[model samples]
Target: MSAQTPEAPTVTTEERPAKERKVPRVVILGGGYVGFYTALRLRRRLGKREAAIVVVDPRSYMTYQPFLPEAAAGALEPRHVVVSHRRELKGVDTLTGRVTEIRHADRTVTITPTEGQPYDITYDHLVVALGSVARTLPIPGLAEQAIGFKQVEEAIALRNDVLNKLDTAASTWDPEARRRLLTFTFVGGGFAGIEAIAEVEDMARAAVGYYDSISPEDLRFVMIEGSARILPELGDEMGGYALEQLRKRNIEVHLSTFLSSCVDGHVVTSTGVEFDSATIVWTAGVKANPVLNSSDLPLDKMGRLNALPTLQVAHEDGTVVEGAWTAGDCAAVPDLANPGSYCSPSAQHAVRQARHLGDNLGRFLRSAEPTSYEHKHVGTVASLGLGKGVAQVYGIKLRGWPAWFMHRTYHMAQMPTFNRKVRIVLDWTLALLFRRELVALGRLHDPRADFRDASAAPRPKGAQKPADKAPQSEKVATPAP
Candidate 1:
């Protein structure tokens, strides 16, 4: 009677309070400049085991956006312009996934990978650096035909597409077809749009030398800006100078004009101008990644994350939201250098904000007060082509080759790791030694074309219809350059 069965090990509903992990998990969304630089700094600031840093992005590499125009113009190698996350971010977990939603109240994020089931990831701290997307208007065929200049892939595709169009123009005898192929329209007059149009125009002009029938004069490079001025960031004087420089290159700059529609290749603009063009580049503008709306974070009227000067997410009541941080194009961080103004969304602010954020995050993890983000922008520089550019550095305005040289030097000094810097410099050196590579690798986009063509060849008697449709490549019209 005394030998009672050993009481079954009692387990309470709240048994074994979930073991609190030893390391704080900090999650960063997006792998662009902000995310890349922040994670890179954090990797060095914290011990590998002290805090777990995870970076989630749809792209495995971060495209140095300032170099995108060069990449498109074939001045910089596409691969060198993009920094590989795995190669640069050591000891940090890299996730190739898109953050679908973030529930800050629950401290969890929903990540949908390129492949596989969606899963939730919990975090102690969150960094919202999910940058911006091409801001587009609701015009006909804009989404279907227009290409963006945001990513490296888009740059490569555009380069090929431009060259392909040139090839068509060279071979075609039809006036309408030649006109469409030779006409290239770019919308927006910001740094991105202007730089892209200028660089590509230079490339196209150079390429025409190789075509038998198409001449540089035959090509029409049109830029349609909605505002009354172009390069508004450069002030009225410099903006006017830029407009003059563009006109000298035969670039038609339409002020106070907006693209009305781009149905097929027929482009209509608010300026009462209509034209047919094979390629339409839309660098119009960018808005904060819509992913921010999926979270409960506070947003400004423009839909940018409301952030404090310290780079912490802020509440509507002007209070910091704890355990949250943001910078770059997504966050409207107060600009200490300019009173009553927020930092402009540019690489200068993005890089500096990242460094400050990483330092602050390290302090935050150690239960120390975080420092505020502050910086005076040094200058603005833009490359037009191989040896053409404009810059306003420390109030000193420069243009032509001198400005172009500064653009390269400034960006070269700032282009992430030393390896990348050296590689880019070497590329420039090689270009100086040899001729520019005008060969368009458009075939790269359709590598399986030969295989498909071989299989679709007229077979012997009675060829049955193929069970599965063979993948078709986008038809790229080639104009020699």
Candidate 2:
């Protein structure tokens, strides 16, 4: 080696090729309303040479959650209610993974992909939009038996499960079992709980016609609300109207009631009511995604990221954390329209906040002054069933078909992408022309179950079947040798 040293191959700093500057990368966490819209806006605002954008989420699509009730009711096709990120974010990179940790101090995030090893991605900017998850209580059997009504999958599963229960109930002869199967329980009385119970009950009632043994009277729909009223987002007047409408439809509305337990399909409530229900839906509420706790960001007492009205992550003193922005349910964004209050976690706020955050983020990248986000509450609308609804807009109240139409029109207009909008409109148009489909594809939840059963080891050739075998008592008693 000394002989082949060749003067140590001396090289100066100038001899090395200059290290190329990396294009600033913007890493967005989540693909919900905030993540998708921010990425889309950034792609349009920044050139390829200016910055690189990456969106990380476990799901590849953004679910239009407002229409989940309709989709579950078969008013709209399931596929039409979700938008594909890869299709929408043309110039941005989409990563189907979860952000395990965020080291904003180092400008890097750890992503755990569905498969493969975890990796760290360095970013010049970070967007926290992980959104919310079902806020479940520690009630007995909730984790084991109840299902949430958040994602499209859950909606579809609920639809199939309800229909399947109806099918089984129609074929069963046990009155108790039939009653249990026919009883459906919903926990919570917010918009989600009300809308979900209403839509699903509508579907089930219509489906009852297909089963000669089952009638609309046989179905029992129960709603349990811990609060003093349902649909509190709507004022007491509208809430009372909604309550009356649900009761008129034969739904049992339990105000100031809580689900005490639901062990083995036996539901016990705080109001001393008890029932056995085959289907239990938990739409109680939602909390910020817990993943935020893993990051070095400032969080409120409720675990949501502390966000300034400008959508930037900030300290309690209102000092902005450089290069970090957040919106949606995960962030405690101040409601500038309402002094001393924070924006409520609703789709209306989420969509508007995402757009505002996107604009502010773009301004940030371009070294421009950011503006505050402010939007007054417009109204609240809810679908009771296929043709029934309730709404309060700009201090005006609406009910019946007018409210239902408003619900559809507002959501359809707000849905992202023309492709999805057209598809959903077509779905509605077709729905108007035909009856709601009542088929239950229950196997969709466990598609491999049938295949696994079929692939099980076949009976050995010439092996005697259990039915073919002689009874132990009938077989001639042979004395052990």
Deviating ranges (above 4 Å) for candidate 2: 1-21, 457-481
Evaluated at residue 136, the lDDT of candidate 2 is 95
TM-score, every prediction = 0.91, 0.91
Q: Hey, what RMSD does candidate 2 come out at?
A: 7.4
lDDT of 1 by residue, 139-198 (tens): 998998899999999999989999998886776656888899889999999999999999
Taking the candidates one at a time, how many backbone clashes does each contain?
8, 0
lDDT of candidate 1 at residue 303, scale 0 to 100: 91
Which candidate achieves the best lDDT against the true structure? 2
Q: Which ten residues in a row have the lowest lDDT in candidate 1?
A: 470-479
**Tens digits of per-residue lDDT for model 2 on 1-481?**
3566456676675474545545789999999999998888888888877789999999999999999999999998999999999999998899999889999999999999999999999999999999999999999999999999999999999999999999888766568999999999999899999999999999998999887778899999999999899999888988899999899989999989899999999999988999999999999999999988999999999999999999999999999899999999999999989999999999999999988888888888788999999999999999999889999999889999999999999999999999999999999898889988889997997989999999999999998777956666755543121
What local lDDT does model 1 show for residue 176? Answer: 88
